[model samples]
Target chain A: MSNQELDVLRSKVDEMNGQLLQLINERAELVQEIGRIKEKQGVNRYDPVRERSMLNNLLEKNDGPFERSTVEHIFKEIFKAGLELQEDDHRKALLV
Target chain B: MSNQELDVLRSKVDEMNGQLLQLINERAELVQEIGRIKEKQGVNRYDPVRERSMLNNLLEKNDGPFERSTVEHIFKEIFKAGLELQEDDHRKALLV
Candidate 1:
């Protein structure tokens, strides 16, 4: 491949990576908000029922080239990460 | 600091990071096992009650330079990550 073509491809990859990082960070922020809400309500941060419902809903809605299970698996991690971010913030607050 | 001192410090940090990575991977494997069990039992991946109990237990046992809340938060993320690993495996199985 030409140097210019390679550079363009690298830039595209970088752009996608940047977007993914932004989304992950955004999700983390949302999780923090959820944690605060749970703390205020005296609710647990880990909600199995809610998680199951989400998975089921996603399964129902999925029309995927990817498997239903694959989608669920990916989303579950995303959800869990978000939950962790919230939990971390709550813990830090409690520590102070 | 001497060059030797810096090298030793860097090595120590690398060793610690490696240990942490191993533990995290080990935890992920355990989570995959738990996921299989849950799938067999028709149980949900996220168990808020179990998670809360764990946090409370950690809090009770903590006599930390770190706060109880900090421990809880860190462990909560660890637990959540493990759960996600399992869920991912289960979902992949379902898709296949």
Candidate 2:
């Protein structure tokens, strides 16, 4: 491929990165909201059963060149980040 | 919060998920292109230096409720998935 072609692909990747960042932030906000509700109900933030089910559902829906394990690992990272965001928000709420 | 509000947040989360899925797929396509180029150049696909630099740049830019480690972990998962996608594409090219 030419330099021009490579540049074009890189630009597209950058655009996707921007979109992913925005969506991840939005997901964090939603996770914080869920955390608030969970705290109010005196429930634990991490639910292993729910996480397992969610991963199973996602993997089932995935039609990919990417393997199921890759998808699972990525989602697990997302899940962990969401959980931490919720916890941080909860801590801030407590301080306030 | 009302049931309606919870529903609203959940719906927003679902919408964000849809966006994330699209962006991730787009990223994967770009990754595959890069893979093809690397294969032609006879270069190793995995670059530890690049991966380290990427994580450092992202963490430096993170103004987050999420910790540095959380961001690092998430990016690592994305990187792994991207790498795997590239390998699979490379293998297919070899067969064809």
Candidate 3:
């Protein structure tokens, strides 16, 4: 009974992970789109002010099984990943 | 015109960020639930094989401006964060 219960919960986690994958990729595409606009306008792709505000906003919205700190940590990683996505082709080529 | 375009894109990004924030919290809740069930069964909360399998599955789903490594990297950070969410209360309390 216990093993079966674990399997059910684990599958639900798997489903959520897939949903997360879709959302992260969707967010990535938006980040890339923003990067393109910034590039064309000769503006920096990453704006720390924008990042700080977004983080603050997310923290405010957080009501969680996870703490505010945990949410902040994960979102910051996501933000960093998105910013890094906008780097120059040469750098990306080197990394890949 | 360029500034206006940026505003639109930035707003979209903000909306997406909000959505991501909600989804991350939801996923965290599921993780905690799974932790509860595992505890009841006297099973360890973290299963690295399951983690690796999820990573492989995410990599397969990757079709992107972000490289495979980048997806893997971001997902690994997320996975680590989720796993930490299941850690002992003493460790979490100390961190908090």
Candidate 4:
């Protein structure tokens, strides 16, 4: 009984993982597009104000089993990686 | 021309961020459900084999503006965070 329940939950987790992978990649592409636009406009890619506004928007919308701080931390990591993507040099992946 | 283009792309990025936030939280909820089931069954919550398989599945599906390595790295961080959420003693939010 419980075994079947566990299997169902595990499969759902797998489905969620697939969805997350797709969404995060899609977000990355959008970030890259923005980076290209910024480059054309001679603007800095890392706009802390814009980043802060975006983070606030996310935090506002986050209704989570995960805590607010955890969500913020993960998004900041995602945001940092996106910024790193924008740079021409130093595109090393975070291996931790 | 470029300024207007930038606005459009930035808004799209914001939209993506919102969607990603929802999906990630949803995933976390599913993880918590699985954790509860595992606890009831007296199984170790952190299954490295399962984790490796899940990571490989995501990597296989990764069609990315981010490199495959980068995608893997980000997902690993996410997986680690998920694992942390499952623990009773160490739910300290990753403030990174």
Candidate 5:
């Protein structure tokens, strides 16, 4: 019974991983689009005020088994990923 | 010029936020599915070994500006969210 149980959950986790991969890629695409616009406008890649507000808004809306601090931290990393994408695009634009 | 640049980036951020919201909800849906399966199978909601493996897999695949530790931390919170959903499902089954 325990073996079957573990197998079932593992399968589910694998499936969740795939869904997460897709969503993250979708997010990356949007990040790239935003990065293009940022490059065209000659704007700073990281916007601290906007990021702070986004984190605050997410924290306010959080109803969670996950704590607000955890969300804040994870989201900062996510935002960093977006910034990195923007930086990569900026670098490419410079090369061209 | 600076004001226009900030305004443009803010609009993009807003769009990204909407995309992120959709992705998180999609993740939550998968978590609920796994939770229902766990409830039916009478399994422990938290699986440390599997969670560890998932984090490790993600870390291994990460080619990022986001550090491995950051991914590990975020994933743990995401995993916690999954566990909470399972716990909630377990509780509902008990009440039924």
Candidate 6:
């Protein structure tokens, strides 16, 4: 590819990466909110059955080049991170 | 901090980061192996109850400057990432 074309492609990739980061951060924020709700309700932050159900639901909905197992793995990590944020918030409160 | 001290600190931080990365990757590999086993056994990849139990166990074990909740959160994210790697491996196999 020409230098200019390469530059444009790089920029596009960077932009896409930025968008993904933003989406991931937003999702994290949502998870934190859920954590707060759970804490207030005296509910546990981790729910494996709900997580499995989510994965299965997503797998059923998936029709892609990406395999269902791969999708499940990615989503599971994302969900795990969300739970972490919630735990972090709770910990901070305890420290105060 | 003195310049030499700062340099030493920075190096230590970098070394710690590297160690963490290595550990994370190692954990990911283990998860991938588990995924393969699960696949053979027709088991689900995501297990929320187990995750919750883990978090609680960790919390009970924690006696540190880091809060139990924070510990839980970090571990949850790590576990989640491991699951993702496993799924990714499974997906690749399916595509072949």
Instruction: Provide interface RMSD per model, one decimal.
Output: 18.2, 1.9, 1.4, 1.2, 4.8, 16.7
Measured by lDDT, the strongest candidate is 4
Those runs of model 6 whose alpha carbons end farther than 4 Å from true positions after fitting are A1-96
DockQ of 3: 0.68
Give the chain B TM-score achieved by candidate 3. 0.88
The superposed Cα distance between candidate 1 and the true structure at residue A89, in angstroms, equals 20
What lDDT would candidate 1 get against the real structure? 0.55
Residue pairs that clash (backbone atoms under 3 angstroms), model 6: A48-B48, A48-B49, A84-B73
Winner on TM-score between 1 and 5 is 5
Instruction: Kindly indicate the candidate among 3 and 5 with the higher DockQ.
Output: 3
DockQ versus reference, model 4? 0.68
Error of model 6, residue A89, in angstroms: 16
Superposed Cα deviation of residue B32, candidate 6 (Å): 0.6
Please identify which of the two predictions, 5 or 6, would achieve the higher TM-score against the true structure.
5
lDDT of 2 by residue, B5-94 (tens): 766876677656656666676688788887888787788989898668667766776666566787777777887889988988888888
Compared with the true structure, what per-residue lDDT tens digits does model 6 show for residues A1-96? 334543453344334333333344544555565666667768787878766765666666655333456455556665666666778899997898
Candidate order by decreasing DockQ? 3, 4, 2, 5, 6, 1
lDDT of 3 by residue, A1-96 (tens): 867876787788777777777878888888887787777677877788999999899888888766888788888888888888888542664586
- DockQ values per model: 0.02, 0.52, 0.68, 0.68, 0.19, 0.03
TM-score of chain A of 2: 0.91
DockQ score for model 5: 0.19
Docking class of 1: incorrect
Off by over 4 Å in 2: A91-96
- Segments of candidate 3 deviating more than 4 angstroms: A89-96, B89-96
Clashing pairs in 3: none
Q: Indicate the worst ten consecutive residues by lDDT in candidate 3 chain A.
A: A87-96
lDDT of 1 by residue, B1-96 (tens): 334543453344334333333334443554565566667767787878866765665566555433555455556555655666666688899999
Error of 1 at A95 (Å): 19
RMSD of each: 18.6, 2.6, 3.7, 5.6, 5.6, 17.0
lDDT tens readout by residue for model 5, B1-96: 745765675666666565554455555666676667666677666778878888877777765544566556556766776677667777887899
